[model samples]
Target: MKNITDYSGKCVLVLGLAKSGYETARLLKKLGAVVTVNDGMDLTGNQDAEELITEGITIVDKEHPLSLLETNELIVKNPGIPYSVPILQEAEKKAIPIITEVELAYQINEGTTIAVTGTNGKTTVTSLIGDMFSHSSKKGLLSGNIGFVASKVAQEAEPEDTMITELSSFQLMGVQSYRPHIAVITNIYSAHLDYHGTQDEYVKAKMNIFKNQQSKDYLVFNDAQRELLELYTVNSKVIYFSTVRPTNGAYIKDDAIYFQEELICRLNQIVLPGKHNLENILASIAVCKLSGINNEAIIATLTSFEGIKHRTQYVTTIDGVKYYNDSKATNTLATKFALDAFNVPVHWLCGGLDRGNGFEDLDDHVKCVERMYIFGQTIPKLIDFAKKHDINYEMCHDVKDAVSKTAKFTKHGQVVLLSPACASWDQYPTYEVRGEDFIQQVKSME
Candidate 1:
């Protein structure tokens, strides 16, 4: 993607009127692109569409017609629209340059970018990196999959600034020439299989983060993911972060975070619990060091930075029972980490869209869980695990139901954790919405 300032008279189709699509359409139109927006949802009363209509941008809703691609020079796709979508498949046949909103941001992004892609911890790692920039004299913007769209951030950015982007595999897959000065892969897991179809395709899409990177660019990753080097070709300089080995990157040693023999912070200094979170800190350390940030600010940021919202965020204590909202743990692996973070007996609430996932691995983690409340579409599978382990369990219809049911099981000094090991699409559109609902329900108990 080039730094295109003027799209004057350029024909572009912004597919899907999702957050990224709306932002992309607006930016492109402002730049003088002949932009037409398309979405599968009806635009009858959509306030989002109404705003775009005032700009005179054409809107095609309910269906994606092949004729919409006619005379189009570019297709800026919303990452949420799967590759299997008819329009995207048709775009491929016509050789239209298909790209995500982030790709468009890459074109106009004047600032240096740090792109993070992985199954889990991407949000936490990206937010931690943002804190590193914020706590210091350095300036950067956090956007992308973590909530804010990248195009919106890049539009107002200056060359002196940096963009800390949290990218998903879906977002990365449509990238063509989008290269980050610093690329981070938190860790690859077998997730989003329902969308990507296969683990290989998912991994390939994630590896796209390094595709356009030059030799001078830095690639930060888990030392555990050395297979990323073995599995895919990477030309950028590799910087690793780990709790395992202590070389060529930032790592932990003697309970202190280190960047190649340089001490950043002790484990106790970081307010975030869980060893997985320490890995996030390690990634931030490597990024700050590469960006020329000092150790003091890095350690200071680690000391005060509470975790991201929706992912292990603290809600409140009711009747001495502590509640943590980990609604962002959309997979078994992520929920496993959440469970491992708490050492006390738990009244755990989990379940949601199955996505064809297995909970067999979760059986071991349930040892700390005193009772489990299964929720959403995966109740039967989760119930099987509860029965297998002989752990007390019940079922719920949704997040609100789960939260209310746990109230009955809550005990003083016990933990009530909402670490659903499945996606929230079965109940809520996104994890954030699901998390907010969980927090709301928990608060109502008081």
Candidate 2:
């Protein structure tokens, strides 16, 4: 693979004018490369793209012209663009190399990268690791498939800096030579199958994080993620983390977090609740141990790390009823964690854009839940499942209506939980937006 420094004076085509795309163009231009930005969205109406155009960067909107590919040294593709796209197919046909924003960022940034990839808990784990490094006096930046893009971090990263990147399967699918010094697979499940077309393909995309790592670099995996263990074969150093104590690597033995080298923390003392967070904590501790961070510092940070919002976040207690905003539970496995964490009579608020999730996994937990209030696009399917299981359920048109109805049905001692096991795109822009909306509705109930 050609290093990014070798691209000086080379013509490059940056496909997709998203933040990452625009940043790639800017970075390439600064490196003395002729950069052209291509996006499917119209620039005449896009304020972001218009601002970039005013800066003298060449912009191609609506459609990508084949001529642009003919003149470029490489294509820095946005992950949102499918590999099956005709333009990309044509680029491949012509033997033009294509890379993702992550690949580009990795090439330019002269620092050790610790990438976190999984079906869930990536953001939480990434943030925790970043916080750990920050407290340890290590210069660290968090970016990637999470809200912060790698381009933003790459712009400021120095040689001694460490980067914690949260990678999605979509972003990983297009990565060429991007390899993290410490790569972590938190866990994997069926997700983004709609884009990948198969579970195997989705897993393969995630596995790419370790594909390019050298033997000296570390690769971390959850012992519980059997699928990942079965499918992955690596030449790099491998470490395992789990809720149960493993003979090697990091694990929970009795109520404590134990590592092959030393004891990390007592699991019982961990402030974060649920078995799912135990896995996340184990992953973070494993990374910190590998980085030579002291056990005391790791424990101190983990104890105070309150966790990210929208993931089982406590909202308010109204008339003795506690409400939790778990609007980030966009899958059955995630919702299962929320249910497992709470022992109270739960007035569960669930349902949204269904991603072909099998509700069968949630059947037993539904019995524990006092009642379910279904909403958004998946209400009918949830209601049908509820009826089949003889579970008490009610459908609401939206989250606001669901919260209002939940308030009426919930007793003073019961917990009103907004753990929607589906995507929020049907009604809200993002999971954070959905969570904020739920908080607003809960506040209005008083």
Candidate 3:
């Protein structure tokens, strides 16, 4: 802890009490802030809430009454809670300082931070960077969007520790002055438009990762996004990474990944699947090299590491048919990448919450998909795409159903892939839950 007394005697309201909310409330209370938690769900018999209540933290359940804002000087909200919420909109009117847990983490953190944000690949890159540091002399504390709440990890981290945080657009929008020492925007694309309401606003939210950075800090950007570079101005020292060609930062030269001029590893040595992962690898390499990690440690981590769970993760092969769980796709671009990774015929399982977007972008990418196993709220949307493309299709209730259907239809040398190109909220609580369901369903077949 920074021994910072800045928050002492302040009235702080923590909106939406999930894992992040629980952590944030406790942290604020320790800082001498009078904390009040507002959760839409009933917290009765909730052990986490009970612990907080015993500790003198208040809990207001069922509704977010705008009256709570009258007492709260600051609002630390769960990232998923929209600003369109009545209380949040009123807070904006009252000029209350609203921030996500990430901002609070940034304020009290003793560790140097390396934050990553993108449409895709951020989780993989963040995790890989953490692994790289673990293999090297330095320590990387993984936090934020990857699962471990940023505030919780920051409390334990020391000055020597490096925080490798994976931030989402939702989290970034709440930050006021959360500047990391090294920030990376792997690659931005159209995503979470339902939350942001526009592509430009979504891009703006992603841009917040580097907005507060100073001249001494580094911004590791995708060199391929010339349009993004042209449109957005980065004030920090820019280090570019590319899967295309040579760059000042990390780049592919002669089939090997390099940071500046030094070689890190060859393309063939990497075990992680998908060509899209090459961009992630390059971004990770840039961050590691910037942090003074050696090529040996970088190469070691890259070669030994398999893909992240539920992100194109290879499941067991049953009767010569391989299964992969990529429930974290949640968008068309990610699904396209997952589809492109396989050369063999794929029993493509997809569909989820209907964001009212067309799947025309994936029209050309479904060439290798032998059949489409559609499920969830977006089934009709996916079915329309399949019909238009003259592709084989089947409709299912959810991921488990899709997996079961896929197993029956898949043959020798073919693949069963659960890469839902939509949010998991329609059927499951999280993408992890949906992926676990798919995995368990596949296991039952054996």
lDDT per model vs. reference: 0.88, 0.84, 0.92
Best by TM-score: 3
Tens digits of per-residue lDDT, candidate 1, 1-446, equal 23465578999999899899899999998888999999888889999899998997989999999898887889998898897888789889989888899988988888899999888888888888888888888898999998898999998788889999999999998988899999999899889998999999999999999999989999998898797578778899999888977968999889887898988778887887787888888888898899998888787788888887888889999999999999999998899899998889998889999888798767677779999888898889988888888889987888888888887777899999999999989889998899999999998998
| Model 1 CA lDDT for position 229 | 73
Q: How many angstroms is residue 342 displaced in model 1 relative to the true structure, after the best TM-score fit?
A: 1.9
Candidate 3 wrongly placed segments (more than 4 Å): none
Candidate 3 residue 16 C-alpha distance from true site, Å: 0.8
Model 2, residue 372: what's the lDDT? 85
**Candidate 3 per-residue lDDT over residues 133-231, each given as its tens digit:** 999999999999999999999999999999999999999999898999999999988888889999999999999998888899999999989578677
Q: Order of all candidates by TM-score, from best down to worst?
A: 3, 1, 2
Looking at model 1, residue 51 earns an lDDT score of 94
By TM-score, the better pick of 1 and 2 is: 1
Best by lDDT: 3
Clashing pairs in 3: none
Q: Report how far residue 361 has shifted in candidate 2, in Å.
A: 1.5
Worst 10 residues of 3 by lDDT: 400-409
